[model samples]
Target: MNVAFFLIPKKDIVYLKEKSTMRQALERMEYHSYSAVPLIDNDGKYVGTITEGDLLWKLKNTPGLTFHNTEDIHLSEVEQHVQNLPVTIDAQIEDLISRAVVQNFVPVVDDQQTFIGIVRRREMIEYCSQLLLQRKVE
Candidate 1:
């Protein structure tokens, strides 16, 4: 099956721009209760992913940094520890399993490397589980 079938389109998900402030990222992440979110460039291309750990580390490493001052810090300043590898729209289901194993959600990009959406690991797992159950029933 095509990976796109499982894609949660960009319009339905929350993503942050590289130029956004650290405070904004924190607020968005907190509001959505997401541990991580996809980061995009000014041109809407996938840059990387930012996680709660990244923010915590940034706060710890930056001296005199506080919640009040996060607004002054750009998300670009936060170091992303996870590469959060992305797959192309044409990629197959088999192509996504390994990545899904390590990531909460696999970022999906188009041929131009534009940030299209994400394929949540839960979706993949449920699909596979359904297939296995069907085989057992047969």
Candidate 2:
């Protein structure tokens, strides 16, 4: 199946800007109940990803700093250490699933490489479950 069949539309994505604070990112992550979120620039270009682990590491490693005081810390600063893999909108569903297996979620981009949305592991699993159920019904 084409990725478009399972693509999480841009509107449904939870994303943050590069200039945002780690605290802001964390808040969004918590409020949305996501383990990770796609990072975007002011121009809406897909830059990378930030995970809960990344936030925890930052809190643990940053001496004498608190999450409350992270307002001064830019998202870009944290994203520098994040693992971001490239993914295209036209990619097949199987390839997207493979990438998600290793990355948790894969960022989708347009032809210009602009950040569009994410294909999350949970969504992939749900899609697979639906496919399996459909086959079983048949």
Candidate 3:
């Protein structure tokens, strides 16, 4: 099956811009209650994923960096420990499954490398379980 079958379109998801501030990343993640979120560039390309751990580490390691000063720090300054790889729009389900095993969501991109959407592991597992159930019923 096509990977698009499980995609949650970019329009429906919350992502941070490459130029966003560290404070912006924190507020967005906290408001959405997401542990991790995809990062996109101004050109709309997928950059990487940012996690809570990344933010925490940044604060812990950076001397004299307080929550108030986070606004002065760009999101780019924060190191992304987890590099969530992206797959093209035409990728197969097997490709998505392989990446999903290690990532919470597999970032999706187009031929131009523009950020498209993401496929969550939950949807993939549900689809696979349904397939297995159908086979058992047959």
The TM-score values for the models, in the order shown, are: 0.98, 0.85, 0.97
Best by lDDT: 1
Task: Write one digit per residue (lDDT tens) for candidate 3, span 21-138.
Answer: 8899999999999999999989999999999999999999999999999999888789999999999999999999999899999999999999999999999999999999999999
| Residue 37 of model 1, lDDT score | 95
lDDT of 3 at 65: 97
**What TM-score would candidate 1 get against the native?**
0.98
Q: Give lDDT: candidate 3, residue 68.
A: 97
Report lDDT per candidate.
0.96, 0.81, 0.94
Deviation from native of the Cα of residue 54 in model 3, angstroms: 0.7
The global Cα lDDT (0 to 1) of model 3 is 0.94
Best by TM-score: 1
Give a tens-digit lDDT track for model 1, residues 1-138: 999899999999999999999999999999999999999999999999999999999999999999999999999999999999999999999989999989999999999999999999999999999999999999
> After aligning candidate 2 to the native by TM-score, how far in Å is the CA of 14 from where it should be?
1.3
Q: Is candidate 2 or candidate 3 better by TM-score?
A: 3
Model 3, residue pairs in steric clash: none
Order of quality (lDDT): 1, 3, 2
Q: Which stretches of candidate 2 lie over 4 Å from their true place?
A: 79-82, 133-138
